[model samples]
Target: MMATGGRRRSSESDELELGSSGESEEEMEDSSEDDQENEAEIQRLEEQLSISAYDYNCHVDLIKLLRQEGELEKLRSARQKMSELFPLTEELWLDWLKDEIRMAEKASDRENVYELFEKAIKDYICPEIWLEYAQYSIGGIGQQGGIEKARGIFDRALTAVGLHMTKGVAIWEAFREFENAILGTLQPSAGSILTPEQQEMVNAQLDRIHKLFKRQLGVPLLDMETTYAEYEEWADEPDEFVTQVYKKAQQQMEKRKPYEENLLAADPPKLAEYQAYIDFEVKDGDPARIQIIFERALSENCLVPDLWARLTLYLDRQLKIKDLVVSAHERAVRNCPWIVGLWKRYLLALERHQAEHKIIIETFEKALNAGFIQATDYVELWQAFLDYLRRRVNFSQDSSQELEELRSAFSRGVDYLKQDIEQRFGESGDPSCTILQNWARIEARLCKNIQKARELWDRIMTKGNATYANMWLEYYNLERAHGDPQHCRKALHRAVQCTTDYPEHVCDMLLAFERLEGSLEDWDLAVEKTETRLNRVNQQRTKAAEKEALLTKQEEEKNVQRKKGRSEKKAAKRAQKQALPGDKRKADQEEWGAQIDQPNKKPRAGELEEAEEEDMSAECGLFGRENNTRILETPALQKQKAAAAARNKVLHDNSKDDLTVFVSNLSYSIANPEERLKEVFESFGHITDIRPVYSNRGLFRGYCYVEFQEEKAAADALRLDRQELEGRPMFVSPCVDKAKNPEFKVLLLESVMIILFF
Candidate 1:
């Protein structure tokens, strides 16, 4: 029992000690919990203080929290507090006004809300603050009130900002926000109040946006991709801000649906679709539709000739009749005469139709009149006409008399063409070889007069510089046809001359000439001409080598001259630098030394005299050396000789006079100089002196003049003029009759009119 009691006491003491320790730990835990609560409270207070430090930030936070909590009234309360706390800050005032707007909108008081926002924005000078306020008001009062209120608000803000117009950032931001407000209100669902013209203005603005930033709202498919980012930035807002974007997309999709369906439902081509088609006689060929497209294309802002021509081709393909095809082509030509391809196609179609000779002739003349058939085209047309004649006339079937009559007609046409070409050549002596050759060939083949043909060709080659390869070939063919060896040889020589400077042409023409002659001399001459042409080509190729050699020599000489010039400049600079400084220093030191020596020097009678004598000798010797060095002679006589040589060269160059003058007496009169001048003459000297006594294009002065080197020559020309020249006589006489020679003033007036006519 005693042991049990002792053990129990000890256990009780230990338990007690343990309980005390537990109590201490419990107290510490309680203290720690209290400290935690105190710290949390302090942190909460610090956060509240920091948030409410700026009234603007405080109002914003409160509004955000109230909105999250669905307590708009509390948001209003906080915003009011913010406005009262900082009434001068438009941000706080705007926030308060926006909260009021939210409340008013919640109560369906749109007018009151708009008025509040409008007043706040107007009274606010801060663009950014007012802009933000306007955006928030938009959220509460919907787009109409928001946009209307915003436009007025922003206009005032802009006017206020105008005072500080140099503030570009503020001005641009205001404009951007204004545009945003306008865009936000632009939804069909938002119930826009725009009239038709106002809607059009909005649409135009939207189109401009889409065009400038293609991927944004209203861009075309063809717009470039570079605009995507810009469009994305402008459109990177909540759906509420960009509500009408999807509506536009839907409208676009809806507009395209019918066209797309029409395109899709279009049937595969069927022969039956070509209806109203006389030839193919099918249904639904859509010729009328194609014609409509053609007409529409013709009516486009700028007519496209190619498109019109293509449409005509489409119509012809659909109709599938040669007559309709030709008709459509002719219609296109009449409509668009400047379209050469269409005209050509029309001509081709006419050929296909096998039009009568008279019709073809009329068509050709009409084409020429319309300025559609160029020289080359005329050649093609002529060939086609000949082919037609060959096919229809059947020379073997026709009698010799008919054949001769046909040849006579061809001769008349050739004569007309030769006269035309000769007139042109007389006007402009250097006529194109192509026209000349065409004229010659037409005469040769159709006229069937070999002499006339040869004369035409000779005239062409002599006058038109007809050295083309084809000319030589034509000449050779003519010679071969005439069975003239000398003519053939002459043509071959001309061919050689034509190819003399071109090695490739030489090789080809020489070989051809050899083949024509079939002689060893011909072959040898060909080889010689070809080798000479080749050597000439080589020399020409080496011309660059000579130029390079000259350039290299010039470069080396330039380098030498540059180096010498640089060295001379450096020497002159150094000499000038050295001479100035040395002379200055020597003069200063000599003056000082002389002053010192003069004061200290003393002399006996004979010693002073000898010293003076020695000084005089030294000065004389220095002066003599300076004079000898400075008095060098220049070679001006050499320049005088050069000038004399140049003068003599000028004298020699001017020693000859190559000009000769022949004066005509105005007293010698041609009765009708205009009529006589119009008469054809082969040479310039055909009339001794031809002068028109006309004042204008058609009027004639009474007295006319003509003179010749010999008086009898003048008389003979006057007789011919009277007999054959345009049915009028030209007066001719010596200048002894001074009455016919009018005063200079009268002559000047007539001459002025003549100049005007000419």
Candidate 2:
């Protein structure tokens, strides 16, 4: 209900006038209502921040709301909280700086503003912030610090972003103006030359201004021509070195202009262009320029953890500025706290720099609470923290505070995995229990405390790890390295009893251990134990194998019985139907979709004509037989028939004579023989019809008749004679009744033409 500036619009508000019937009578009442709504909204935003500290937009919205209501304290808190997690934008920093500057009353408040400026510049290289910083420092010149402090800030600002292509000129100009302002104050009189000391003061101030101008001109930035022209106008005499530096800077600026122009032409967070720009700066081999470009890119793409990581890597490897490297890592983790790698890298960076023990521990605690998505991330983070703690321990000293802390962290991590991690992720992330393994190793190898190590290994096995042969071997190896032969033999004996996955490997390990360190009776006992365990395991496996084989045999017999029953039932039904059938043609027509063919048995002489004559008489006509029979044709059958006709009409319907090729010797198990035959001979010419012969049960009978569009196409198709269909060579012969056409012979074509003109 709280209005977001002017964005919250409603139809009711649009319909109402200023003094509408439902309007508040007094402006004070209306204002109080808005204040309450804003208060509620502020509370909601703050609550959201509490729930999700990394909610970047929520923080920004809260800060904006607080600033709008002039809740100075709340605004400061909101901005600080947001900046702790995310690098603030230049706009947010400017707003924050301006507010601090306006509210700052005492010398101490001014110093706080200075500290705020320092934090702001670290987030991004904003010349405006630098300009603001310099200007703010100018106000403090008379209060406590003198002009030198202001000059020092301006100089640092120029050093940071002085090589900036477009905005670097602003900082240079501001520095010069501040120096000029100081110069004016240092001059004794308006018309007379100063005394030696005073004159020296004025000259030194002029030299500072000169050096700033020279530095500005030497750097490749936007509006260098303006700087050069201004320099020409201001200097009493021309300096060729300055001119050459200006020319060189101009050339460099021209080279950089295209990239900056692309940045301006593209949208915000132009990552691709910025990457190309970063490559350009890095190729120049200037650390200062590379760092500046990286900061500029990060200003827009702060949420991009990769960008921050790259910047930090570059600083660590190339620049080696400790503050910048630490800041980069810290900011990377802030921007991407959920990224475990970033947190790990931050811990390393902090430790590499030998940061305070308290700060490092605090950072590790924050990483533990960073709410990583994967349970493995938590495991890895704990491992990192444990490694840091272990590094701090003096192994030479038997008992140290660092060693105690490390041991405590180890126990705490294991407990956390058991209760918290397993509850959240449904299983402990460390399936191998690497943390416990490390702890045992540390206790054995560093503390030389085999008893403690043995205790740890016992816990490891009890935590759902008893069955693993590898774990047993791991414990055995550790005991062998750090414990006595008696303990080693004990560990191996327990391993042989408990190892299930590879009991033979552990048995062999125990035999090897007994050979090296056991007496004759001890070796005899070990052999007996090994033989018994192997015999039991082999017996159990043999029984399981026999049971599995029996079950498989039973399954096969059941399958055969079921299949025979289905065949017998089908046979009986078919026989009864054939015996009781009224009209064979009608039955064939009804089962047309199934393509059930008539029986292959030869009929008695004249029996077919007699049956046809009787069927015709009963239906009044053969073509009108549908009226008397239960003939059914679904859309799928019709579509199949239509597709058959579209490819080529059947041979009986065509006018062409002797164009049908009889194809035989196809694979009986081949499905869709018509389509398969067509594919084999389709390259010859247009196919007229493909009729695959099927038996009464609708099974392929290994033969079909393919009628072509022309006799030549049929002749060409005959060239595929003995060519394979479904791995069986087929006979593609002309469709001739041998008794009727004795003279007909299948002459293989040496050359053939498909007669499409026919």
Candidate 3:
């Protein structure tokens, strides 16, 4: 059918050509066969294409087709193959590169991929690509690099990113390089030594590293001045700054050095360094840390005086009293006599340490021998001795022997400080007031005799200048302690008379007089003084209230007068308006209304003067106790003061030595007790026989028989019994021996006594 159609078409074309040209049959048939073969081959090729496609190759073709269709996912997958195979292909490579860049960014593997892109950028000179490469290099460090190498990498990175030169990104990259340099790029090799040139390289690298670090920190490196180098030359001097460097270098050695090596190294001002740490730690409120520091300090030579004082303070606060701590402080003071704090702390530590007083006295003696106890400390030591003696005085036992010894020591100590003592007493300077007054109080307390205290104070009052008024007041306390009411009163009165400059002291003395003697009259006098002050205040207040009342009353009268005048004016206006015509009356009414609505002006000068006078009068009437609550408050305070004085007097008079009895069990018996009683009686140096009184049948009675050598002996034994027996209270009256009667046997005596019940 194709040959026939082609022949017919050929005939038709030949006929059309006969109208224009000519054609042949064989050529038309040949053309027809060729067309049939082409159609069949096209069909076979289409079938082969469907049957022969490989998955990867088909994917590549599909990708190309999808790329032309703008399918990015397919294009990306195909680009991945090309990247794995022909990675340097500029078309496939750029596509692969861009896609890889995108993938690297999406996975946050940009830092890992940055090197590859950086190479690409250097080769291509693509500013946009280079910027992307630099952006991804933030916080990235070369793994196999030193500080110099790191600095070069940072400079290159900065130059690349500097094309954009945003401050925020530059800051981040600089910090990253700085941190990398400090932390180091690689682990250090053990026992590794470098050549001199390598060392020089290292030093140059370190300098660059330090400069970069400083730049990142915003601190100028040139300005640092190598504080250590400057002070190292002056290290032998004991100045604060040299000592500070010594301290810091020691710390660095400790922090960076291994423990074993640290132990083996030569001593490097370790004591001074630990002391610095101790001072710092103490200021930071770390007592235990300070303790560790102090321990280290003392371990490396003995601790310095200042360090010893702080260490003892730490121990004292912790309540750890050790012989070692005591020895440390004492040694500190001995080594440095000028360390006053150490001296004080040594004494204080002794006070806290529960050793005997004799031992403490020995400690002070040791301090004196060491030349650390100065004259001032000697005075303090005396006061401590006196206080110890006073506190030891008790009703339990007579501490008189100890007190006398203490007093002797105190006197010796004062004599030791005598030169300073005399100079101090003669100074009479205002600054010496507190010290002198304290000394006076100590003197009063230490005096065994009230008469001595009184005599000493009298001498102070007579020869010692008028500057010693406080000393006089302290002496008043001695009379109070004596429980002599009249003496207390006289002392207070004399103290008040001695000085008028001290009103508070006078008032205090007055108050004390009232309290000590139970003198309600003095209390009333004190109240009267307070009441006088209150009354003066009340009188002034009353005058003010009276003046205010008068002013208010005058203001009320003026208000009434104003209302009356307004009423008269309104009546006059009404009368005037009542006589006018309609329009004229309206006009008059408007005028009157305008006048009525007008605001009242301020009062005239005459009225103001009158108001002022009324105010003065009211305030005058308001003066005195009627206007002031302080008048009432003052009376209440007086009542309280009186009650307090009376109570204090009662308490003061009632205060006395407490009753104390030290009880010890003498003897206890249950069976064969009469023999034990005889033994007891014999031990007491007396002639006495004891017989057990009991009922018949060998049962014992609760009473016993006692016979003494004589009547005086019997009475003496009874007296001793009353004093020694526990809960065996007895009535010591003489009685006849009933067993001595005619019919009474010794064995029946118990029955007789039991039957008689006596």
Cα lDDT of model 2 by residue, 545-657, tens digit = 99999999999999999778768866864664465335645655554534335433333443433343333333443345435544333333343444445356333433344
Poorest stretch of ten by lDDT in candidate 3: 653-662
Model 2 TM: 0.66
Which residues of candidate 2, in runs, are more than 4 Å off? 1-32, 47-54, 84-86, 184-198, 250-262, 518-758
Model 1 residue 143 CA deviation (Å) reads 67
How high is the lDDT of residue 597 in model 1?
61
User: Each model's C-alpha lDDT?
Assistant: 0.47, 0.79, 0.47
* Clash-forming residue pairs, model 2: none
Q: Give the winner by lDDT.
A: 2
User: What is the Å distance of residue 363 in model 2 from its true position?
Assistant: 2.1
lDDT of 1 by residue, 416-450 (tens): 34565345444332244444454455445544555
Once fitted onto the true fold, the runs of candidate 3 whose alpha carbons sit more than 4 angstroms away are 1-276, 279-292, 295-304, 319-321, 351-359, 369-375, 388-395, 419-449, 459-469, 503-508, 511-758
- The candidate that wins on TM-score is 2
User: Per-residue lDDT tens digits of candidate 3, residues 1-758?
Assistant: 12421222345655567546444666657766976764465445434535643223344444444444444554554544433322122243355456556656433465546555644533222334443444444434344434344455456544433222112234334444564455453324678777787677666655554444333222111212343343334233335643454455445334323432333353434553454555565675644334444544553544256556666777776637566567656556644555555666776666666667877777666555443323454455455555655566552443467656755654555455545544645532222333333434544555435565565456456654343446555666666665377777666556544553453555566675686555677778655654454456568679999999999999999999988876886686576445535654365356445535653433354344333332232233332222221121222233344444434432111111111111112223345545655664554345434544433223334445556555455544543433334344332323423343332255255444533542
